[model samples]
Target: MDTRRLYSFIKIVDAGSITRAADILHIAQPALSQQLSALEAQFGQQLLIRSKRGVAPTEAGRALYRHAQLILRQVDLAHAAVEVSGRAPAGSVSVGLAPYSMGAALALPLLRSVRERYPDILLHINENFGGVISEAIMTGRMDMAFIYGAGPLRGVQFEPVRSEDLYLIGAPTDGGEAGEVALEELAEVPLLLPSRIHTIRQVVDSAFQQAALRPNVVGEVESALTLVNAVDADLGATVLPWSAARAILDVRALTVRRIAHPVIRVQLSLVTSDSQPLSEPALAVHDLFLELVTAFDKE
Candidate 1:
């Protein structure tokens, strides 16, 4: 297989136009088109659908794009490994941190630690939802991620970091005091939570189901800032892990009550690709992440 053709194909797919890809690759448009044709002939499939607007990948092209990304990443890692052996690891490592969890608190600290310890290493940090981060890791677009679930996911491995207890945060006017609150008591309280796709929402929903009670969820909020703001405005109460609640809310200004009568806890895990081995720089960042998590847990 020609790696050059694969690279060109990826560029074409990303740019969405043969002319744009040609400009980016510094190759003639005719030559780039020939490469695309050769790739199509070799695969015996029409990889892309060309239209007046641009080129879009076919189903086969999407599959090839995924494989090509992994292959190119592996090739880069192999070169970096050999070139940086017995030297300070120097390369870029992309990491994802799932929002609305412990990741929110650790982002800045992790960035500072990496910058101080591995000056030669360039770190790319992405804060997103768990599903998005997980898919990026599975596709080899991310070296690793800290996510909020330990459930089995194909094409990735999860290492348990810690579990966090859920709490109810509300405005001071709506709450009586700061103490443990039962699930039954919250059945009537208007709630603001993330969508059903989120792991936190899934856990909250399951607890409600097991208790044989339906929560009065008034809104589905995906943004941490918006959720906190809504709760602060007395629009509705929200359920979140203690770390996330504290990181985004001022305890003195809000009422944070731990949920009792069957405490709900969510697992935090470090996720990595099952098939792709981390490069030296990525491995270094991974170790640093674990170390920081451990220290934070102790504190």
Candidate 2:
């Protein structure tokens, strides 16, 4: 099979539309459609089901896609292996980071290290909530992600990086460094939390529920900055992992006290799908990520 035709087919699948793939490939739409027809003819199978929203792969297309990804990744790897003469790895790698799990404190240092050590490698980092990142990893949109270990683990493999103890954080005027607060004590504070389904929110809710205490939540927000700023403005106190609050708290000068009477720790993990092959660049970044997370993990 022609690798070029295979690449075009893969692009079509990736874009989910011939027009989008044509635009990306800088080819006319008719020309792109011809390429797809040729591939289907060669395979003697219908590969895609088209619809108004987009296209989805038939079973044959899915099989081809899986194999095509591996084939393309291998081709890139071989090209890099020869181009650098084994001096350094070179290729594009996309990694996913859960909103705060792989925050700025981890990102800045990570970018710096990858640049210094693997100058030839191209790194693409994506930040999204855990669920999105998890799906991305499984579908090969992302090679890996940092996810809440306690969340659903159906499609990916998770390695526990470390656990972070949750804390009660608020503005200095509201409660500045008052020392550890009991788990039940948080039930009394007006809380700004993520929606209930968010990993951190679920963990916090379960902890409170197990203790037969209910949090007095008043508002919901997803952005770390917004949540921290709400606390900074004294809208309400919030419970979060120390690392999640660290950089934001420093900038806003918010106060964080450890949660006690029962120290609840959320298991933070590195996630990857076994079905996807890891390229050299991805592996390098994965190793560096593990090292960096360990160094920065206070717990």
Candidate 3:
């Protein structure tokens, strides 16, 4: 039997459903089912039982699962050893980045450093939203990702890199005046925000709720770039991360201010799968992120 088939079975058992397991493995359900069937044939007994709720392992399946877990863990250790001892830290590593993150600013420097230091290591970067990037990490598509926001998520470990101050960005105040604006006073101005699901959006909304104010929203955009563009056009104003705001701030045209009652800040964090420690290349990337963020803090 293919070792990979056993791995697939273990994944299904751990996930409790073929569909969920397939998603985690980044494979199709049909292919995953075939792998399980092949594994059962090798063992000469049925391995999985399916019912209304989902899938469960049979007696034979449970026996194989116990062995499979041990074998997979060993295989992982072997791979890790080989990678660490390999020529020039060689191996491909994939990382996902939240769309608006300093990933471009941070990752580029890190990538250059890795390429210079470990020429054989291959690096891949994916740009996505916080939700998508987090999902990709959980599902094993990415080693880790840079994301912003709060809270704990099942199957993921978050390491906060730093917190960035949030500011209200809008067309320049009549004379470029910089000061605090009460959220209640700003409530009457048309607003542009990210979708409610975005972590930043939720934080900003929670602040509004606490103040008992409903914003006069003009639109909700998916990306920081689009939101900033909307604000630049004088369509309305929106809360923006400093990294994003600094990129678009045309000193002559855009105005930014701190909100009163509650000062808002968003935590930028690194997200990784809790199921396994990151690969060597991935660990390098994580370390590189720390260096970049630290340098930025110094500046």
Candidate 4:
């Protein structure tokens, strides 16, 4: 396979227009079209669906795009390894932080640490849901991520960071207390939580199931602001890690209580692609993240 054609195809997919890709690549439209044609012919499949809006990748094209990204990233890593050998690690490192987790609190610190320690390296930080972040890492679109799961994901390896205890967060007037509450007591408390697809929801659900109790979930909320606002409005209570809760809410205004009596906990892990080796800069950031997390845990 011609890597040049792969590069062109990737650009076309990203730009969503052949003309735009041609302009970016500084090549004639016809030449770029020919490269696309050659790729389709070699693969014996139509890779794109064209329309008035532009082109979108077909199923095969999406798969190829994922592989192409990995291939291109590996090539870049190889070039960097040889060119910057023994020099300060330098290049763009993309890091994903799962939203509403301990990662949210670490973002600013991570940025400052990376900027101070590796001035030559460019850092791209992304805050997103765990599933989206994990998929990005698996596809080589992100160098690493701190996500909420340590379970088996096909293309990624997870290093367990810590098990964070889940706490109940509610409005101040709604029995504002600092003591631990049992899982049984939460069965009747109206709750607002993220959807079932989220790791926290899954953990909460499983814990309730084992206790043979159904939680009174009043609403499905995915936004941090909405969740905090809903809780503050006395619409319902929510569950979260202390770090996550503190990141989004003012502890003084809300009631925070640790859940106990069958305490619920969620695993946090550092996730990286199993098949792709990290470049020096990425590895450096990875270690720095671990160091920061360790120090934060101690505090």
Q: In TM-score terms, which candidate is top?
A: 1
Question: For model 3, what is the C-alpha lDDT against the true structure?
Answer: 0.75
Tens digits of per-residue lDDT, candidate 2, 82-186, equal 776666777777877776554545877888999999998888887788888887776666887877765457768887777888887872333433678877667
What TM-score do all the candidates reach, one by one? 0.92, 0.82, 0.73, 0.88
| CA lDDT of each prediction against the hidden true structure | 0.90, 0.79, 0.75, 0.90
lDDT of 3 at 113: 81
Quick one: how many clashes does candidate 3 have? Answer: 0
- Indicate the residue-level lDDT of 269 in model 4: 97
Name the TM-score of candidate 4. 0.88
Cα lDDT of candidate 4 equals 0.90
What are the runs in model 3 whose C-alpha is more than 4 Å off?
6-38, 41-86, 174-177, 248-252
lDDT for 66 (candidate 3) = 68
Clashes of each: 0, 0, 0, 0
**RMSD of every prediction:** 2.1, 3.5, 6.1, 2.7
Give the candidates in order of TM-score, highest first. Answer: 1, 4, 2, 3
lDDT, residue 93, model 2: 77
Indicate the worst ten consecutive residues by lDDT in candidate 3: 171-180
Model 4 alpha-carbon miss at residue 11, Å? 2.5
Give the residue spans of candidate 1 off by over 4 A.
171-178
